[model samples]
Target: MNLPATYEYYAVIPHRTQPAVLLLHTENGWSLPCWQTTERHFWQTCDHINQTIQDLLALRVITLRCLFINQDTGSGHFIRVYEFENRDAQWRPPVNGSWIGFSEFKTLPLTHQMQRAVLEAWFTEQMEGIPTTRRAWARTGWFDETARWIVEILQGQAIEVSEAVQQVRTWERSCLLRVATTYGQVYCKAVPAMFAHELPLTQHLDVHWPSHAPSVLAVNRQQSLLLLRNFGGPKLGERGIFAWWEEAVHTFAMLQRETVTHADSLIAMGCPTRTLDDLIEDIRALLADTETLFVGGKGLTNSEIAALRPHLSHFLNLCQELKTYQIPYALEHGDFGPANVAWVEQRPLFFDWSDSSVAHPFFSLCLFPEEMEISFPDTSDWQMRQRSAYLRPWVCYESLERLTRAFEIAQRLAPLHHASRYHRFILPHMEAKWEMTLMIPAYLRCLL
Candidate 1:
């Protein structure tokens, strides 16, 4: 999809001393630089920084994604951030000319050599925690804070470490890095609220299915962080997709089964619980009070509310019909698919459990092939093969006869259960069309 032509890309390359905030010394004066488009020219900045690290320090670097800036004039721009590990030397401009810190870059101390101004410095507003957010971290900026947290957790466990770490890369609500210390290269992570169960859930597996999951070396659940074996290797893919899926799917089913045994513990610890049984009530309850559930009881007009009201009866009936199966409930990977599992050393370690919800184990598999195909459309016959592989576990538990019956019901009911989540009259997210997909069956069945 081509966005508006006015959109552009820029970078805020950061180092120990300060951030490189696009300073260009023109004949007019020294000013912040920006790009009109995110074409090859913009990528060159990221390319230069990455090359400098790979060649000079022999250290790897990963570039971060866009930090958007919405201007007062209603225009917007975005800049990606790149962080360097093992700061070998204080960074200097990739090109030669007068490049200085942001404070000094503003004074125009070398006004005589200045030539042009590229952008209206949106610096003040943009600097508000944009450098090192909870989602993304800067080593010199927030690594120490994270390091201190790690140290406290380790000291309590009586483990020692070296002063340096191999690298740190932050994403949405977690940080992944290789800590160079007394132990060999160990992988460390700080998960977000959504995936807090990763540590405890894995710890549970250690006792029940140690060979199937990652060993939690050390962890601080309060901080949503943990350390694990680096287990460095490419995740199963490229050519071994089917072989990997069979093992991965079986392992996933096993994990969900184990989760069912400890459902109370996991739920008490804040894992999302959305049971198929409860969904019937949730759909009706939300429909009854649609106005409040969406946006403070005001998001939808009365006409819209009336339109959705009658459909709830049929949706609730379908939910009741599906509940007859009583197909086992457990913690489900709400977004389960091939990409979510990583096969390491022949064992499948399921990652990205952020979408955990309490539902029928088979219900989770309803979209196994559908989800993966959406993510990777090119793969053809493999899609059905993967689905068959995923369904193997269910067959093992109830035989294909029962498994097929349960899954067919799930295909129809899962959509209604999912759509009911937005009964507060809130519109579904544009890209998340799955919500609408859920309601379509009920709408068609009831002619609403």
Candidate 2:
């Protein structure tokens, strides 16, 4: 499918003593280095920007932060401003672009009025030397404070910070940075208010299951930051070995079973409780919102939406039936797949608990079988084996036949789980809502 074009203007700035911005001279005038692409999401846009800058200017930079977003619905043109960092202190000017000082940049003729305004706002903020209230990591001072903390924490552990901290990823939800140390690498993760539970939840996991999760070195609850020892391994399924896949399912099932009694603790730690009854109410509300179900011409058609309305009764019946078996609720990793699992020392250690909740454990298996099939197509019985591995720990609660029936019911209703999650938790907190446009409707259509 062809996506709408999004024009991105990057303000490349060096994070050093002298403040400057990179600009390229065009026939019209000078402007921040810009590019146009069809990629809409922040991560994909960051990838495209990095590659384009490398190819065009032979320079490497890291995404500092998002400066602004202009989403003009009438014109159907979206503009995004991103700040990128050139970490080198002795960097030279590129062949076609020059690093203009902040004072001199004011006098240059910019190609667009919008660019000039954006640069002026940035310059004003830089000159005032005021810390940003939002996303403090975008500023250079954040790195310095973080580096000192890292040294303080590693002092008694016989480890030292060996190199500069490198940013791994940044977006609306979270930012990840990696620090190279004498022993190995450690990661620092920061999240916003919506995902504040991730810090405590990860610490809980490390305390309860030290062998299966990363070690937490330090935590700042006020800032929602976690310093963790790197759990080194390739992502699950990267090796193409079916044994790892089977083991991941089995181990995850064991973890879920063990945590069933800790549901209250998990909820106390801020994990949202999404019971079968709660899911039913969410589904009813979603079906009633006609506007969102059919928004943006890309969602379900009129006929499909009509067909979906009558099936609400069927969906509710499925949820009610699954609740009858009395399967105890546990921690449901909201976004479970091979990508979230890491293979460490021949075991599966799950990470990225930003989407976690306390709900029906079977709901977690909604997408695992489908993903396994895609990864190992040659293995005909992989899905069956995976189900058996996951359900084995739950056999103490119900017969294998009855558990299989419950699994089927959960699978049929899983789309509602995902749609409700996006509607309630994910989309509302995002700045670039268009990046996830129609996600709720797309998941709702899976019910058909």
Candidate 3:
């Protein structure tokens, strides 16, 4: 696939207390303060914009909320508009930019038609206040309120807020903020309503396995926010140490084994129950919904869907056969992979519980082996060794041979499992469904 050559970012730097935006005098005309880069994703665009403003304008800014995205297909010129907050309100003025009032901006000539359109949309959004179509953090004043709340929480814990809060990452699913305090740096995470369970789930893990999870300092249940102490470690496989993969799988399996007896409580605490029987019914519904299964051009073709239909009975029988092994259901991290694991003090810290559920434990490793193979293609039988490490914790329930067979069965049905999850839990709550347009069909295609 050919990547876009350049991405032009427009920063809507709103005044601290007025309805005005910072505009720069460019060769074309007066326009919103802009930066250009080769980065594709909005988060990376935000990062580059922030760095450029800091270097040239000697001002610190945070780009948390995105207003618009457009791509010129002919030129491959990607345009992104983001709302930026100036951290240091008292700063030197830029040589070419000045704060232009909302009414005054309309009288000036813009760089192009697209710039005018973006500014008009932004001004309309400002007049309308916050919209329901986007996450709460994307609105004006959300960062200030959240930062104040963080300061209050940390101060109550005897830690003084020392530095400005910085944006770590923000996307459709969640927003991560880094807070610097006298004690150390802590992270504040805010999730949408769809994944509200993450807050309580992380707290539960912290209470049960403090050594393997980040410490939850405070929580705002109403906002689905969590403040976590820094784990002070690098991500698993960050340095390309392959042995960490085996250790991570072993640790994750032990967590599943330990949580087996708490399945009911976990479900009651908002963890979705994805039993094999439930998954089978979900698959049936998916196959019947031709409209959703064949929506996008990239979706499964008629021939592929026909081929997958015949496997329904085989999938049902596989689910039934696995039940004979009598392996108890437990906590399954729906999106488990090396990226979600942090290696701290010789132990693996597993986080990001937004996709967690109570289901077949073996289902957790369905994609693990494939991910490992892709990351370490030169290592022979690495998948087998990792599977062994994870399965050893379950030897008490069934023999290694029986457990391996159950794992295979779960792998065959994993695609349907993930497809059902997106169709049910994720898509409906998403404000921008286009971001995940291909996820369900992509997963379902694995069945063919």
Give the least accurate 10-residue stretch of model 2, judged by summed lDDT: 42-51
lDDT of each: 0.54, 0.80, 0.82
Model 2, 119-153: lDDT tens digits are 88777777887454456666556666766777777
Mark the regions of model 3 whose C-alpha exceeds 4 Å error after superposition. Answer: 1-5, 14-25, 38-48, 54-61, 68-79, 85-129, 288-313
Candidate maximizing TM-score: 3
Please provide, for model 3 over 321-352, each residue's C-alpha lDDT reduced to its tens digit, 9 standing for 90 to 100.
87788799898888887778899999999999
TM-score, cand. 1 vs. native: 0.62
Give the C-alpha lDDT of model 3: 0.82
lDDT (0-100) at residue 330 of candidate 3? 94
lDDT value, residue 433 of candidate 2: 62
> Residue 441, candidate 1: how far off, in angstroms?
17
Task: Indicate the TM-score of model 3.
Answer: 0.85
